[model samples]
Structure formats: structure tokens, C-alpha cells
Target: MPYATSAAFAHDWPDTVRLVTVEGAPHTGAWNADAYAYAYAYAKELAAFLAQHT
Candidate 1:
């Protein structure tokens, strides 16, 4: 999990925030995963979040 300090954006702006945290994922891991498992893992959730929010 990321440290609380990493959530400055959400902390500063609680409203209108859509935070996504992937445990143990390296920087840019979501977009750069070899098998794209990280990206795929959250694809549906992200899509749903976007659909509801947007």
C-alpha cells in the first residue's frame, strides 16, 4: 500500500476525487506490466468508476 503522503491529491481535495491504488505495484506498473495483468486487473473497476463519475 502507498503511504498517506502519496495521497496528497485526495487529501487536499476529498470531493471530486477518484483514487486508485494498486498494492505493491511499481511506478507506471499499470501501463508497463509485461503481461498487463495489473492494467487488466483494474480495467473494469476503472471503467465503472469513470462511467458513474463522468
Candidate 2:
């Protein structure tokens, strides 16, 4: 998000890592009102991802 430090880390993650990118999202996308508007759905997606990964 925003090509910031955290985003750079995610981008540099190894191939085995799971990386999810929310388009048009801000730094803290889940709480950003103007960005990631569908946060409830995003939460569900994140939960599913964690469930599968962990």
C-alpha cells in the first residue's frame, strides 16, 4: 500500500510466502474509510487465507 516501507517488505517476500494486495487501499486499509471500502469482505478473505495458511 502506497509503496511504503511495509509494502516494500511484502514485495520482497520470498516465493513461498503468501502475499495479498488490496488495490486502492491505504497504509491501514482495513480502517481506511476512503480506501478498502469493503473491509467486512476483506476481513472474511483474510480469515479464510489465515485458516488455509495456518
Candidate 3:
């Protein structure tokens, strides 16, 4: 169960990475293409920031 309705990328992963997956359909955690686009944008932003910071 995640915070749906509001876009939030929450997951406990074992990597220096973040994955955002949007919900699709019912009773499932399917991936929406649009959400992936957003996630890609977010990842780019983060990467840029880290690159600048480090």
C-alpha cells in the first residue's frame, strides 16, 4: 500500500537509485508510461544535482 492519488516515489531498494512507478488499472501495481516519463524527468533532475554537488 502506497500513497496513491498523490504522486510519491517510495520504496526500500538496495541501490543508489530511485524508481518511481505509477499505479495503473485496479488491484495491481502496473506501470503507466506517463508515470515513467515523470520518473525519468525526476531521475534526470536528481542526477544533475548530484553531478553538480559532487
Q: Best-fitting candidate, measured by TM-score? A: 1
Question: Per-prediction TM-score, please?
Answer: 0.47, 0.43, 0.38
lDDT of 1 by residue, 1-54 (tens): 444654776778877565666666564564554446666757876898889879
Clashing pairs in 3: none
Cα lDDT of candidate 1 equals 0.65
Better of 2 and 3 by lDDT: 2
Model 2 clash tally, residue pairs: 0
Better of 1 and 2 by TM-score: 1
Candidate 3 at 27: error in angstroms?
25
> What TM-score does candidate 1 reach?
0.47
Error of 3 at 51 (Å): 0.2
Per-candidate clash tally: 0, 0, 0
In candidate 1, list every pair of residues with a backbone clash.
none
Ranking by lDDT: 1, 2, 3
